[model samples]
Target chain A: MTRTLLGVVIAAFVVLRVWIWRRRRATGHERVRARWGPFAGDVGLVAGREMRERFRGKVFRVGTLLILAVVAAAIVIPTLNSGKAQPQQVGVVGALSAPLRAIVVASATSAGATVHFVPEPDRAAADRDLRSGRLDLAIVDGRELIVDKPPGPTGTSATAQFVRAVSNDLGVAEAVQAAHLSAAQASALAAARALPLQSLQAATTKGAVHTTSLIGLVLVFVMLSQYNTWILIGVMEEKSSRVIEVLLAAVRPIRLLTGKVVGIGLVAFAQATLIVAFSVALAQGVGSDLLHGTAPVLLASTFAWLVLGYAFYCWVYAAAGSLVERQDQVQSLAFPLSLPIVFGYIMALTAAGSGSASELFKVLAYLPPTAPFAMPVLVGFGTVTWWEFLASAAISIVCTVGMARLATGIYRRAILRTGRRVHLREVFSRAAG
Target chain B: MASLLELVGLRRRFGAITALDDLSFSVPGGQVVGFLGPNGAGKTTTMRAVFGLTDLNAGKVSWNGAAVGPAERRRFGYMPEERGLYPGMLVGEQLEYLGRLHRMSGTDAQIASKMWLERLGVGDRARSKVEALSHGNQQRVQLAAALVHGPELLVLDEPLAGLDPAGIDTIGGVLVEQARSGCCVLFSSHQLDQVEDLCESVTIIDHGRLVVSGRVDDLATTGPRRLVVRVEGDRDASWAGGIAGLMISEVNGGEARLVLDGDVDSDLVLRVAMGAGRVTKFVFERRRLSEVFREALG
Candidate 1:
């Protein structure tokens, strides 16, 4: 009876706690709802239109497919290469003296290596392989054990032992020739214990680093370029179509702009997220190791910088769109506006190649224009401190606000200026007035 | 009728060209006002200024006796001269999108959209994309978008410009219906006959300034009415001119047509026609609005 009473009390307490939690959650949700309020009718209207238009647009559909395919390749190729075995090609440089060849092959077998005896005609090629880190060791002249600089006797011990046995057989044969030893006697001497020699390392770790960084480069570039251009072209199209005019009529220019930045930022994120998830699935399913040694923080930082970069650059593109009245003007305007995107991309590529952030890159990490490129690199190489990242993020946020406000001012003044391209001074002066 | 919209001294300039010079007009509720001008005569500029699609360089626009901001302008529908409509969108769907822009929810917008499509004679075209629709059907969709939210006033720039006879008739009926529903309908057109046929009132501008504005027939006549006489003349054309205030403007097929001075009485034209021959017809031109329009403006 006492145990039953305790269980009942505990059940009641748990229920009470859950009820309080739900109530608080509800009230907190209500507060946020009241705080954020409902968006003006035009914002949703424009976003819906943008969503429909882009979803149906040929450029968007086809471009998305191509990018998805590329992401799939990046993931699957490496996973497939992960299983490739380093051929245990041990090159025997001299005329094989058949028994010596057998010992080298046997040692390679114990080491789980695949042995190759180079023909005398291909001696030069075998030497080149040894230098190039492909061939493990060269059993030269049935005596000399040649390899790339030995790994503190762990490598040469096997090669040294194999060579000494072959030399001992030759010594025994010479003794028999002076006092004439038989082939059986020479064979016994060859079978005895030989000196320690090391074997060369297998090509196990080759191409792993090469493929990983390649994937990173391609992934970072395609994502940044595709989404950033989306911002530029999307804004330009909206402006030229005079859709913004109707949109601004309903909401304040700032709200309208904010909603657009948020909406498309979400869309870019969704695209990146899908590609990442799909590629990860494809890699795991296909058994590829292309992404080996890559930092997870690199993916996280890439997404973070994507958002920051889009926020910082979206206002500029929107402002540029307001400056032009015609479609042709948009093409010319995009190149100049896109220089920062291009420069940042190159800088990020260089950082990836060097595997470290430079001073200029560190400074760029703080600037809103370049942070998208620099932040990802810092995160990848483990070079950035938390405070540095926070500073960069804070700067980007502040700049986004300022740029949005400035853009609103210009768009308000310039969107209606349709007869000619509006000069910056005109938009500024008109705003002031 | 109460004034639905009023523009006071709406002046604007584009570099060296003065697009609107002290332009002003008022559109009262349920009134169909024809805005008439030649090309580059500032008709579109004035309409755009009233719609707030262009910033007023030097004037104010009042809606329902209150100053209109951008928010108020959203409630006012405007059909620009260029006929802006997204081409690839479906006809019914585009109207719904535009309706939502003016604050209708999706389902409500769709309901309104269907009703408008039926009303515009495009019920069969509801599912067709705008680019797939004929140009005339696209125009109907454009009109539907402009009217979907039931705005209190509509500013149409050359709604009749590129229509077939049937299309012109259909749109004319639509404009009249809009006016009858207590919405102020202000549309610009170069078709004088259409202006005379559809508008109760009209404003004509030439060279960036007001030429005349008032009741269409009244504004077309600048002076007192004159008697127009026709007579079958066999003998002397000189005898027709002998009557005071009677001048022969044309003579053909043994018939003489004469314009009388505004002060001349009808009996004098009868007397003058008797001198020409046996007066087969003695009728005065019934102030043909076209003649009056030509006499005053042309």
Candidate 2:
């Protein structure tokens, strides 16, 4: 995962820079407006700076890519070795001829079991796997079966059912032999009975893993939150240091703050893109079958949501950062701001795990801070229509604009009024006043 | 022609602390005005109030006959005591960016930044990160950033702070050059001698109230007229009791300190001192601004 993040860092610098150059050259006011966007160039610059700085950070960049790599491994490893671990993998002891072995497979099926003659190599691995809770049960001598001792009620009953079936089979066969049944009759009975118990159940397919882009989205949101917070803190640091007073004389606060946020956001986008591209290329190159079925939507949503989520959260953090002039105050303040993010993330995770969006999760999708994470999860779940995605995007964009206004107001109101952590009350009231 | 910047009845409150209480002052163009005070004297607070960084509880700041809003303030430049420049950004980029913020376009910003960097003798360090610059050089970068837009008014709070003699000369020369170019420069400094050299006018505030303000020489000289006389020939002569127009106050080291009548000239006092003894030096004491400040606050 950490290795995968390397690509994002490289891609962010190259691709985002290209994007910026393209933005600069874009034509008319309307044309420029369309391509460069109203705030994207500025926002991109900030995000880009942040992405570069953070992706270069040993902890965040590496941790996220590591997580993605782990996810890829989970999706791939199981599917690649598909046909090996099933209940049909039967364990047997004692010397039996090849034809008798076929008969035992028939008999086990007759008793409602499909047997795979693992022949020792698998039995050794199965023994280890059983201890690790992998296999359902191990059959020895086609009679003495070993099952994992599951806690509480379920384990004993299942064991009893297996034992009773094997014993009943032996007893019925013995009774039939005493009544003078021929070998041909027993063979006919076993084969006909084996027909009644076919056991090949398909597990959850990898196709479903592609649909789980929420994890990817959460990654983007978390990164956006962290990067945006960095921007906020950066602004506050300047203001508290009394630098803003001088800066105000040179440029408007709105422009300065906007430029910073855009710069950092662009950097972040680059880092994320590089990591995504790196992982994809690496996965493809390695023939890592785990990534073979991983959906592009998951990666795409992650990148898109990262940019969108940052647009929404950066202003809030920057605004929040402006409220306090001192570094010590940042930690206490960062917590309250992060609460919505945490709540949104938790709700999104719950929805992802259920493979469905609940009504409550839908509410989270509309919230600006949460939407970047939650809405993407909804899209991944096939739970949202295109209109709904568009609606969420629009709402998020609106929320971002509103947040920028609110934050800028809060920042401008409180940044110069330093000395202690100015109460949230003071910030609110001053803004209102 | 009248003044570049004016603050009328500026008042600010931080909870119970009235940082500035109805403060008012003006700085005309083509001169440097000294903003003087000790710690807690609202020097910085007043500077902030003028820039419109702090909300005016009840007051106004006007620049060139128009109210100083955020846009209006963009035409002015300030160097706050906080000493801030983006640490991670390149020196050239930061300067150009600030210039742009002041409404300078790309060509103008680039030109100003390049010229200023060259003037500072730091043109080679343009691509260097601000963090990599020396403390004095960083301060130079900050000054450059402030002036890159050629603002009409420059408010520099503690402009001479944290500098060695060489740094001071460079800044002082720059400030004088700007003032000579008809820019109004209002700066606060603890170095009274520096202020004496640089500022034509001085405003001294204490405890959120204006104590004294006027042309520096006028304010210092406009108080009571007092003279110091050194007499070589006589120590016991009645230098104190009998000289007309000489309100002598203290006598020591064969010299008499006296206050002169308003219409009195130096010759009258010189004649009296001469009658007492052969007068070598007769100097009038212009009460140092520092002494005036002490008298106001202490």
lDDT of 2 by residue, B198-236 (tens): 888888898788988888788778756878888886665
Q: What tens-digit string does per-residue lDDT give for candidate 1 at B1-298?
A: 4547887888877666788888877888787898876789898878766655566679888998888876677677777776666656767667777777777766676777878888889887876777788778777777887888887888888888888888889889989998988988999887878878899888777667777677776664555444544455463456666677666755666555566677777786677568666777665544444554455456
Best by TM-score: 1
CA shift at A335, candidate 2, in angstroms? 2.4
Interface RMSD of each: 8.9, 7.7
Model 2 vs. true fold: TM: 0.72
Q: What is the lDDT of residue A164 in candidate 1?
A: 40
DockQ of predicted model 1? 0.18
- Per-model TM values vs. the true structure: 0.74, 0.72
lDDT of 1 at B140: 79
Cα shift from native, residue B124, model 2 (Å): 6.4
For residues A251-306, write the lDDT of model 1, one tens digit per residue: 55665666566666666665665565555555556766544564455655676777
lDDT of model 1 at position A55: 46
Q: Relative to the unseen true structure, what is the C-alpha lDDT of residue A98 in candidate 1, on a scale of 0 to 100?
A: 67
